[model samples]
Each structure stands twice: as structure tokens, then as C-alpha cells.
Target: MTDQFDEDTGDYPLVMPGPLWKRFKQTLADFVLLLVNKCKSSYVFDQRLMDGVIQLLTGLADSQVRAFRHTSTFIAMKLSSALVDVAFGVGGSESKEYKT
Candidate 1:
């Protein structure tokens, strides 16, 4: 995810990830949310990681893989919720560029 970041725009490329990427993304999101839940303050300072997680959530939520509809939906909700907390953790300092 971070590899796809556009330095000029500070946004990820709008492209559908590969099939194998689905599991990798899901696992990473799960781990990220777990870490955020356990150590709320530890991740807020890593803006790049936060940016990737947000991008990951958006991608997974928008995916049309059709293999794990329920699971994807559930994880999306969890990630979205964790993101809200992360946003507050940073005092919502995320720049407009990152939001796109």
C-alpha cells in the first residue's frame, strides 16, 4: 500500500489490487487494528502507516472480490472505527492531501 503512495499528491493510486493481495491486506489491517487497540498512542505519530491503513480500509471496503463479503464488511467496520480513534489520537492533524 505504501508502495503505491503518490508523493506529489500524497494519495494512493486508484487501482484494484490483485487477488492475492486481498489476504495480505486483510491480515495487515487486522494486525494494525490490533496494535492500535492495544497501544493506542504508539501509532499516531507514524503518519505514513496511518495513511496506508486508511487507504487499505477504503480499498477493501470498495472491493468486489465476492469471496469474503461478510468478512470484508466486518473488517471494514472495525478498521473504520479504529481510524476514527487514530484520527482523534493525532488531533486530526491529517492534511487535506492525505484525505484524498
Candidate 2:
């Protein structure tokens, strides 16, 4: 069975079944995480680069947060945790004001 859809009619295809589908999604997530980590490391020596990276990430998270408001709370929690982790890591907790 075909898993792809025709682009003209706006039709959707059936999702890949079982293990293959799981593996595909897992692979995609891993690739994304790898890219993010690379970017994070590459900006360590440049404050301007890090600010740009932080702004981009914040903008992305804002859009996702708006979208997630209608979805499951579990996903929102996961998103919140990830953002907090990044922010805390970037902004040291040495100052009490920085502690969330």
C-alpha cells in the first residue's frame, strides 16, 4: 500500500503501520536533537550568536505553545520542561533572580 498522498487534491495518506512508523519518527527526532546540540555548542564563544539562537528558539516555542494550548497537557508539560532546561543551562542559577 502507498503511504504518500497526492499533492493536488489535499488528500492524506494512511500513516505507516507499527515499527516502521515508530522508527521513522524516532529517527527524525534524533536528527533534530543532534542539530540543536550542534548549534548550541557552536555559539558558546559568541554572545551575539547565542542571543540570536535564544531568540529563534523562543519564537518557535511561542508558536508551539499557542498550538499546544488546545492539545494534551502532557505535551505542554514536555515543552515547558525543555524550554526551562535550556534557559537554566544558558543562564546560570548563581543569581537568585535567575532561578525559575
Candidate-wise lDDT, in order: 0.59, 0.46
Give all TM-scores, in the order shown: 0.39, 0.38
Candidate 1 regions exceeding 4 Å error are 1-33, 68-70, 83-100
- Ten-residue region with minimum lDDT total, candidate 1: 7-16
Question: Model 2, 36-96: lDDT tens per residue?
Answer: 4565546544678646655655554444333222222323344445445556767764566
> Total clashes, candidate 2?
0
What TM-score does prediction 1 earn?
A: 0.39
lDDT of 1 by residue, 32-98 (tens): 5887777666664578876786676567556554333333566667666777887775666666547
